[model samples]
Target: MTFTLGPRAISAGYQLAAFDQIGSTNAEALARARDGERGPKWFVTTEQTAGRGRRQRAWVMPRGNLASSILEVMDVSPAVAATLGFAAGLSLESALQKLAVEANMRRAEPLKFALKWPNDVLAERQKLTGILLEAEAVAGNRLAVVVGIGTNVVAAPEGTPTPATSLAALGVHVGAEELFKGLAEAWVEFRGIWDNGRGFAGIRKAWLDRAFGVGEPVAIRTGTATIEGTFDTIDETGCLIVRTAEGKRMPITAGEVYFGTAASLGAT
Candidate 1:
C-alpha cells in the first residue's frame, strides 16, 4: 500500500514526501529545511535504517513499521517550539484511537492508548510509539523543526528499557499506510488547536486527559540523580511536574520516567 496524505492535510496545504525506505525521516526533513525548503510537509517511510531517539539512542524501524516526520518552519523560540511535541503526541494518540474504533476492536474490548510524558505513546503501559523532535536555525531567525513519530505496526523491538508492543501484537491488524493516513489528518486538527504555541493551554489540557501514569508513583533518571515522586502534571512550559515526598512540587525539564513496579525497582 502506498503512503499518502489525508484529505484534511491536503486541504490544509500540508504536503507529503513518502519514501519506500530512508536512513531517517527526521534527518531528511532537516536537510530539506537547510536547503531552503520552508514547508509544513511530511517525510515518511515504512523502513528506517538509522533513526535516533532522544539522547542519540538508536531507533531502527523495521520494514513493516512506520517512520514519519513533519517539518515546520516557524518564528517561535525553540523553548516554545518544544511544546509542539505535546500536540504531536495528542495527534498520534487520536489517530490510533480512531483506527481502533474503525477496526471494531474497541466496541468489544477497548485498547487504551496514552501519552507518556515528553515523547512516547503507551499502549496498555507498553511502549508502542516513540516521538523525537529536532530543530535547527534557518534563515530570517526562523527555526526548522522536525517532529518524528515511529510506531510498531507489525514488529516490536525486543529487550528495551520499557517493553514494547505493536498494533498487530495487540490484534489491531492495520497497515502502516493506513495508520499514516489517519495520523496526517489528526495532525491537522491538533496542530490547528496548537496554533504555533499560542493555544498550548488547550493542547496541554487535552494531552493530560490522554496522559498515562498521572497520580502514580514515578522515578525520573536525570543523569545526575534519580528524582522519585508522584506524577503530578505538566506545567505551562511543558515541564513535568512531580510531587515529591517532601510535599514540594518539582518541575523536571527532561528525564527518563519509570512508573509502577519499575518506579519501585529504580529502573532507568
Candidate 2:
C-alpha cells in the first residue's frame, strides 16, 4: 500500500517513505540524517529484516505489523531529546484509541489501553505496541532523533518475554496503512503539546493519567542488578520513580521494568 501523509502532516512539512521490505526503518532514518538530510520525515515498512529494539534485542516483524520510524531534527541535548519517547508513546496511544473506537471494541471504556513507562503501550496489561528512540550527532551540535514504533495489528509473536496482544485479538479490524495515517496525525498534535520538550509538565501529567501499573509492585532490572519496589510516578526528568519496601525512592533512568509476573526482560 502507498503511505501518504495526511493533510495535517503535509502542512507540517512531514514526508513519508513506505517500503515493502527493508533492513530497518530506524537505521535508514539515522543514515539519512547523518548524510545531511534534515527532516520531520517518516520511514515505514511492512517487513523489517534486521529490526532491533531497545538494548539491541531482536524485534520480530511479521508481514502485517506496523514498522515505522519518525526522523526529526532537534537542537537539544541528548538528555532532553530522550523525552520525545513520551510524545511518541502518547501519540500511539491516541491513534490506537481512535482505531478501537472505530472498531467499536471499547466505546464506553477507553481506559482498556494504557501507556507503559519509557515507551510502550499496553492493552489489557499485555504489550500492544513498542517504541524505540535512536539519536545521532548532526552538524552544528544539533541532534536528530528517530522514533521507531511497532504495533501489533493483525498478529503478535509467541513466547515473548512479556505477553503480547494485537488489535485483531481485541476485535479491532484495522490495517497498518490506516493506522499510520491516524498515527501521523496524532504525532503532530502531541508534538505540539510537547513544544520541543518545554511543555513536558503537561505531557507528564497526561502520561500519568494513562499509566499502567502505577502504585503497583514492580521489578526493575538495570544492567545486572534488580530492584524491587512499588511503581511511583515518573519524575520530571522522565525517570521512573520507584518506592521500595524499605522506604527508599529510586529514580531509574534506564532499565527493564516488569509488572506482576510478566517476564523480566520484556520488550519495550
Pick the lDDT winner: 1
Compose the digit string of candidate 1's lDDT tens values, residues 245-266. 9999999999899998678565
* Candidate maximizing TM-score: 1
State TM-scores per candidate.
0.97, 0.94
Model 2: lDDT equals: 0.88
lDDT of every model, 2 decimals: 0.93, 0.88
Residue runs of model 1 more than 4 Å from their true location after superposition: 102-108, 264-268
lDDT tens readout by residue for model 2, 1-268: 6677889999999998899999999999999999998999999987888999888998888888889999999888888889989999999999888878765644555538899998889998888888999998999888999999988888988887678899888888888898999999999999999988899999999999999989988898889899988999999899999998998999999988888655344443
